[model samples]
Target chain A: MPSLPPIRPEDVAVAEKTRPHGAFDPPSDAHDPVRAGYLMRLGDDALILGQRLSEWCGHAPSVEVDLSLANVALDLIGQATLLLNEAGDADTLAFKRDVLDFRNCWLVEQPNGDFARTMVRQLLFSTWQHMLYQRLTASRDEALAGIAAKAVKEVAYHRELAAEWVIRLGDGTEESTKRTLDGLAWCWRFVPELFEVDAEVEAAVSAGIAVDPRDFEAEYRAEITRALGEAGLPVPDDQRPILGGRRGHHSEHLGHLLAIMQYLPRTYPDAKW
Target chain B: MSDWPLWEVFVRSKGGLAHRHFGSVHAPDAEIALRHARDTYTRRMEGVSLWVVRSSDIVASDPDDAGQLFEPAADKVYRHPTFYEIPDEVKHI
Candidate 1:
């Protein structure tokens, strides 16, 4: 056999061209604050929920569930990194931002009350995210489209895993069913806010940078209804619409969450790994 | 739950490879067992395919009979391929 040539930095660079992570070249043009805000909103949703799920790292009911929850959390955090990077410096965006500046919807920031509650919130969010990402894969913004394409597969698994737990618990023992119903009821009110399209959302939709969630409102409702039906549960009555997360108005929960998440970074602002 | 059944997992690392036993997981049922196996063993792209079966379903030989079953074969060197002769041109053998 012929002797192999010494590897060079240039050859390593060429070999890395086919690597998936960090392969997508983000657009270099400056984006107005509005467009940047849109990307941050998407990123915040993943980041906040990822943080919530990570709280279960050492505390989930079983080893199997613990791994599964952490798996999904890592996937969400990975998506958040890509999205926040597109908006600006991902570290600054995630570690330095104040609660009022966060754009994640209220659902993700809700406490992980129990396994049932966690799965309920996950099911509600991942279903909506999966549907939205399916459409976003066709976004006019190439960066968003690429992010969506990769994220859609992860979100699909999240949705399936959540649905599995929701159905199993909802239809299992009486206590499990009661807990599942309580989770559904508590999470139901926030469902409407997910599809609420405000002025900024409208601008993004009009520019083809985002899909109009209103277009799928009926389908979303039907999907929830079907899932609930399988669980032998009823849809909760429509409560007063709890809105304003998009504009940075949030419930008290987000502040507490931010306190813990930002503590290390806030205290030692210049620290690096 | 403690009552949950244990499942043995086998994984095929890639195409054209037979599945080798990887590990096990506990789950309430077959469907969840498959998922638990995937989460537990295949999270790092360790396998392209997974198979999960209830551990109780597997039929394993008794370890106490190991001498009678396997040791006799180890000493039977004449039954082995060590005595085979081949041409210098032979490669795979």
Candidate 2:
């Protein structure tokens, strides 16, 4: 293990000046910029999805599903709490960051259109997240490794929740099958974006601080086909890859989501929960 | 959809303790019943194990049968442990 450099008080001052909690612009050249960006990417995925799933709190098709989705949302928020805490102050990282500053993958930011849509989205993201975190457990960065190790188990359960629902819906009544198939269609375009690598991610992988998610692209494809196939749903391949979230580019859906989710913190900047 | 059938949940908090009925949930099938059981009953890390059975599967005598069912035991004082001279050294007893 290479020794991390000694932390100077000036380093803290510089980091804060470059990137305060509510600042609109990300730091241009902060220390460990790639690592900080990677942590934000990880944090934003959980935060966005956690916000999306929370919308189902009172409106699920069934009470069981309501609790199930809420529990899944709770788990993602728990992950967000830890991951964002690592990058910066957890509350500020979540509540203060502007929508354009979030580095979540495009898939997680898609709207939860309906129950089928939400579950299918979860199935896709959680499966990838499980694979991503499993690989990250071996990262040379101790904080990333420790967070990934704990989160891997949580995502395994999330994958199960999503997979089971996909099977249940896809194999259920004619209406359910149609809805689930349509749901998959809604999210299919965003699938390939998960594997898109940028300079920062590339550097992190080279430095052993992160794993290249593209490396597991083949396995992810196979796992998806297996899980969805058993549920009698085919992997839809007609859609094109839609990329951008890692670079702070997002869909129109995210702005609407942020309007509702960020309203409180933005409105009452000084108030406590 | 209407509520799934109700399942009574029982949990074993620790070794050597009997599985005590905690609460219940509604699920369409046994597998989902177990999932719901875990989510609802064990979210607090309250138990080592879970059991979910259809609430209707449990047979219950009428509450009206209270006298005939359990009253006899009340008068059977000899069957009670009060008469035992429990020794201080008998740890668990």
Candidate 3:
């Protein structure tokens, strides 16, 4: 794969503000790409993970689980729409972007492994997202704050749903425990990427357009630690963190995901309901 | 998953409404069952409250005894309030 071009922080910071077309009026600075990028990063996280979760639509272990996963997927997609709309036209951003334009964390783009693995990923991502949204609800940016206010409640339930499964699978029978641990191992490496603060993020933070995730890294870890401990699982030792995705540098998996996600939109280009 | 117990779900759509039977879900415990019920039955703002009980706990009437249990009530038309004269002041009744 071609290496992604380095993100230009100035390009993000200097873009002029423009009004959105719809009923939703974002804050005056919403079109500044730095702020837009900030919002897109959050939206991309939701959009990608929402797509991944929807893969379980007809394939979950039970009918109830299928509905639950789909429900969460829909919630994430809804969040993505609102967040992306703040940045630009949501449909165009979602369907027209190339792999290198995506700003999601690498964690969300990782493929869903087994059921246990999916639950583990959900637990980790939702916990961070919940905290992030809670902080964003207080942001000086009205659009970010308003989006976060609505999203915090959704991520709270997402956190609860995943935590319950993590505890159950980790402390359940031997086979389940094994699968859950394997899931954790597969997912643990990606946690640090969620907290990474790069130049764009730094700009967004310094401008008070975004929260510094590093500020709450300890609390985030403690939250995960508590959940792991309850599941009778030991926290894995911190290792090298898998980074990139915020800057559009993603693993091979994201390319595959984008190919599928962008297919219909790219194919017809004008197909509409 | 088939080995998991079945739970019957009840949903109260609004305050002052009794919970009516909604559907069933399979879960290992009541807490999970309640979560499943929320996802399955209330996704469309269908309920303000939810109740989940183990399906096995409900003692249902036997279909074989249906005639003896309910047929006698069908013939009692006087049990209807139509025999009473309507008082205009009580128009709602």
Candidate 4:
């Protein structure tokens, strides 16, 4: 039999700190198990989208754009780590979970169609994240408040970067502008998901663990409108509620995404990387 | 055609310090250049202030003139205080 290596002091300290705080003892009045689950869903949304964006690491239209996308992806991943680690632990939530256990929104799992589509997705998502994080910074839950305060600054930069790209692509040339409009048209329906205030959200907000998603709708719309206007693109009046991901009914894209994301982990079960 | 021009970036890390040359970025105009500098160079809050000047507009000393312009000062030991003594109470020199 092979003997295991001795554990280091740092590893022991980290392990002691991250030991699970008993399964069901909520952290605070605001810390609902259901809402923690919901926060995980939001975190997963950012994680999946960040992973998708990272695929363009070496294939972007320009080096500046490549670096920008990579930076944005890093910011999203940072946000995901905080939220996921809070929900459970970073390692367990990220690596130990099965595909069926993930609760990310469907739109985030969509394929990166083109630069235009990616920009549109980013614009929509960053707009919502900016508003959400801004309000969440004032959350009664200190941990959540801290996370939000940090993330708010990052999401603000993401919003500006995506907004600039949207304008540049939309107003650049006839082909680019047409593509930008088409991308916005395709992505507009999914915008409703950002503001879908489910029961869990309401409960969490009432307890001060989370912000009311509905409260950000007007600001999101205004920011998006300004961005689209500057981009020389018309905001599509898609009022339909194309919702389901929050309830676990996701678009077909999510399954394919999960297959790719979970392949290595599933293949090497319990293996340390 | 890239409408943007390259701009040299200078960052002041904190208060009461001179802006040190950090890097450069490409941007469409001065306003956008400052913004690009902020986004590209100061993402870590490493700077409290920034300055961006068009690279084309900067007047740089000629590399070929290095011998004539700087070599004369290299041997000027009289400009230094090697031959002089400082008082013990002198805090900084």
| Model 3 local distance difference test score | 0.92
| Candidate 3, A2-64: lDDT as tens digits | 988875877655543343364655446555978899999999999999999998989999998
* Segments in model 2 whose C-alpha atoms lie over 4 Å from true places: A1-30, B85-93
Query: Each model's C-alpha lDDT?
Result: 0.90, 0.87, 0.92, 0.80
TM-score of each: 0.90, 0.88, 0.90, 0.82
Q: Where does model 3 sit among the CAPRI classes? A: medium
The top-ranked prediction according to lDDT is: 3
Q: Tell me which residue pairs clash in candidate 2.
A: none
Instruction: Identify the superior model by DockQ, candidate 1 or candidate 3.
Output: 3
lDDT of 4 by residue, A1-273 (tens): 998888899998998789887544434433558657767876888888888898888997755567678888888888898787678665567766655677776667777889999998998888888888888888887877898898888888888878887898898899989888888887888888878878877877777788787886887888888999999888898857688777777777766766776677777887764
By DockQ, the best candidate is 3
Residue A265 deviation, candidate 1, in Å? 1.1
**Which 10-residue window of candidate 2 chain A scores lowest in summed lDDT?**
A22-31
Tens-place lDDT digits, model 1, residues A1-273: 998888899998988986787555553543656567788889999999999999999999899999999999999999999999888878889998898899999999999999999999999999999999999999998989999999999999998888888889999999999999899888888988899998998888878889998888888888878887888878889998899999999999999999999999899988875
lDDT of 2 by residue, A160-246 (tens): 989988999999889999999999999999998888888999998888888898889999999999988988998897587889888
